[model samples]
Target: MKRHDALIRVAEYDRFRRPTSIRIDVTAGCPIPVVRTIFGAPDKPTETVVNVSLVTESHPTLDPTRKYKDRCRLARRIADRLGIDEGCHVRVDAGPYATYYRVYEIREHDAPLVVHEEHLDRLGIDGEQTVRLSTTIPQETPEQVRERGGLAETLVDDQTCEGVLVTAPHGGAVERGTDAIASRTYDRLDDGGVRASLWLLQGYNPPEGSAVTAHRRWHVGGFDRAVDGYPGLATLTGRAFDLVVGVHRSGYEWIEVGGRIDASVRERVADELRTRAGREVRTDLDRLHLPGTNPRISTNFLSKGGDRGLHVECTPGTCDRHVEEAAAALAETIRRVLA
Candidate 1:
């Protein structure tokens, strides 16, 4: 959508449900051991404020808007999103204020600054041009997230025929950490036809400088080599591949399908999602690709595929608990479509 054509806003939400205040912040680089979001006030009744404790090893910036834009570059690359932010407004009737704490790690200044979210008030930019998902996402602590799964070695299929690529970018501990099942799902795909993979085994933000090639190509770092101006994924795209399936974990209450490919491909993947209900497909022109205020944002590989692709988002609650089983089932469905 054009900048002036239609603007996405918080007011679009039902009057009672809209977020009264919006925040956009960028935290210090990761290996960031602690991130505490203080929700309720000391009394736990009045909505006093929301706080973020980011432990980085560098100087925090005063320009939160620029910091926010830079911080989300990798996310836009990982998820290929083009919105102001993905926020969840916790309930609080009192003064809603925010604090961002950035304690740069003692030694690791190289770690990239990971930006979280930016909204109407945070940017001071026009809301119409931005797309924001106002979700009350549960801020799960690392321990809570680790409860689902652990990190695994980044692995890719031996076959480089470039037919189908199955990926789990946020498998280990990305934004919405999954059990690394996105990568684990590789073991289930029929190796004969698909080029399966389990990359981004580490937390999201495209593990930069961690690329290793003991056997198959292992670009554990963020999208690399840049294809068609987009980074994070280069080799995987640029081919007339059949399908590129990105199995991501959704933090929202429902499952969602993103990317703008052919209608059939989108619908087929949506049909394959193993959700009981609550599914949405976001194909708006700007939304289809991860378009942010910054130039770094671009179309994600799911829609950047040779002939369009499937960006499958899994809702853990509705999906089968047995991740391997659910993943394999979804893989099989994708293979069927390729056939």
Candidate 2:
């Protein structure tokens, strides 16, 4: 696509942020009546003393008459006018802060753009800020979805030992405590002089009373883990890793262990979980239909060609209570297996 640019006064356009209640990543919205009255076209200005509420800060869509897709349509229109491709990245420069975002669907619209609140916060725009929106077609576009930017991540590539990778694709509030367990395992491994690459995906949801759960908003399945934009998963799959351990959560009373690995090694890991972590371990995952056996799954995908990986699914209680023991057990077993 040809390069396009727009020197638009953001916040001047009918901008709205993603509210806690809104499930989708809505960046732009239609201009409200008050905005039209004061800023654009209206016989008499209606909004004299507008009250900006904290609740509204979370949700700035004054006129939420537009549906979820409609909001995206507005942003896409802005992108199109700027000559950006449908799936290409748009480099948005709001003063000092700059971010690259992949655009969603595109349709024609002349309405002013309403920036999403998250983008505003990231760009450090308070109110009525001017931003330079530019587009470029990079040689190698990152394999990421529209909501990829919404999810937070941490990637460690400098320290890689034994070609081992630790991952928590469903981290933060999505899978509750999976991120913590994965983090503990990574830290324990690092402290023990076995530095490994790590990738953690965390949700940015509020603490309590959220209308939508993190899993609903940002959960990327095992098969899609490596395909998604996170660098750690890609690194694991790209290299010849001897072992790849994925931490996850389940609702069952006992922890479940399943992955593409040697039968003896799987049994050993289960036994260690039972003895060291003092938690019940289930090895009959094939019967449960969650064997994690597919080579395309992140656990197996990250491991060496033969699917030499470990997938550990811990219960909520196990994650909270026995994470340290579980991490130690995993590290010890992994060190031995690698050796």
Candidate 3:
């Protein structure tokens, strides 16, 4: 499916993970094709056709109060629209069961931002599902973004393609201490004589107390590498690697590790996290929410054919206070697995 990037937001959820917000933005002008049939005979199904013209709005141009030029401009604006089919609906791939709904309307403000209703009947969302969907990233990076808030940087070894890549897709104030953990992990791995590559994306200037709530704005999922036009992530994703490890912060208290890495490697990492980091470690797949097992996730996509990708979710306290210990746990895992 074609993905278009739009600003997506979700309000706080209740104990059952049901969204309580009034508005949620899904996409910008992404067309969803719905097919239907027109029956000419009462008892017979006649012809089927896709109505593409319904994607945009239209009205009579014969308004007496408006000038010809103004009317023409308005007509053109209405003619150019990203459309969704009338009967075809959109599915939110944010949770276990895909929720199909058609209660969305696109508002043509500065950019097309779609607003949709909350409460997907019965689907239980695991939070990450909201941000895990893919979207297109514009090829151009804006000037103000480059100068201040959003940043993407990379340090790669050009000599070989056998190195492992470590990335923190949501870094800086977006997730607080993730940048430090990712940076330190890369450094420790390099120090331990393991060839490694690093890509860090950081966000700054979140609303005074809304740092966690604003993460969706800065988080360009690992699946979408158009991250602020840095090109580093896209380039790294294209290369063959010995392993790919993604470090992230999670709400869980225990350090959670997931992905397609071997059983033995996972056990070693869990043991290290428990011994060196002195934290509870959880590697059981059945209990992980952000397991990074999806094939499109950065760790899975960048790992050498799904054999060596590790997704490690550190608690907020660990990221803030024990970043070094967590990084050591991962660095040791990488050294033993790839070195």
Please provide the root mean square deviation of candidate 2 (C-alpha atoms, Å): 16.6
* lDDT against the true structure, each candidate: 0.34, 0.53, 0.52
Q: Write the per-residue lDDT of candidate 2 for residues 1-339, one digit (tens) a residue.
A: 100011111122222210111011112442211111112322322221111111112234422332221111224445444533444434344443333344434446423244444433333346644555443211111122212323555555442344678888777666877877777777777667675766676653332233444454445552342232332343344466788888888878888788988877778888888998788888876654357777776778667884787888888887778778888788787777767
Preferred candidate (lDDT higher): 1 or 2: 2
| Residue-pair clash count for candidate 3 | 1
Worst-scoring 10-residue span by lDDT in model 2: 1-10
The 10-residue segment of model 3 with minimum total lDDT is 67-76
> Could you tell me the lDDT of residue 301 within candidate 2?
68
Return the TM-score for candidate 1, rounded to 2 decimals: 0.42
TM-score of each: 0.42, 0.56, 0.57
**Model 1, runs deviating above 4 Å:** 1-153, 175-179, 191-195, 204-240, 274-306, 318-322
Q: Decide which is better by lDDT, 2 or 3.
A: 2
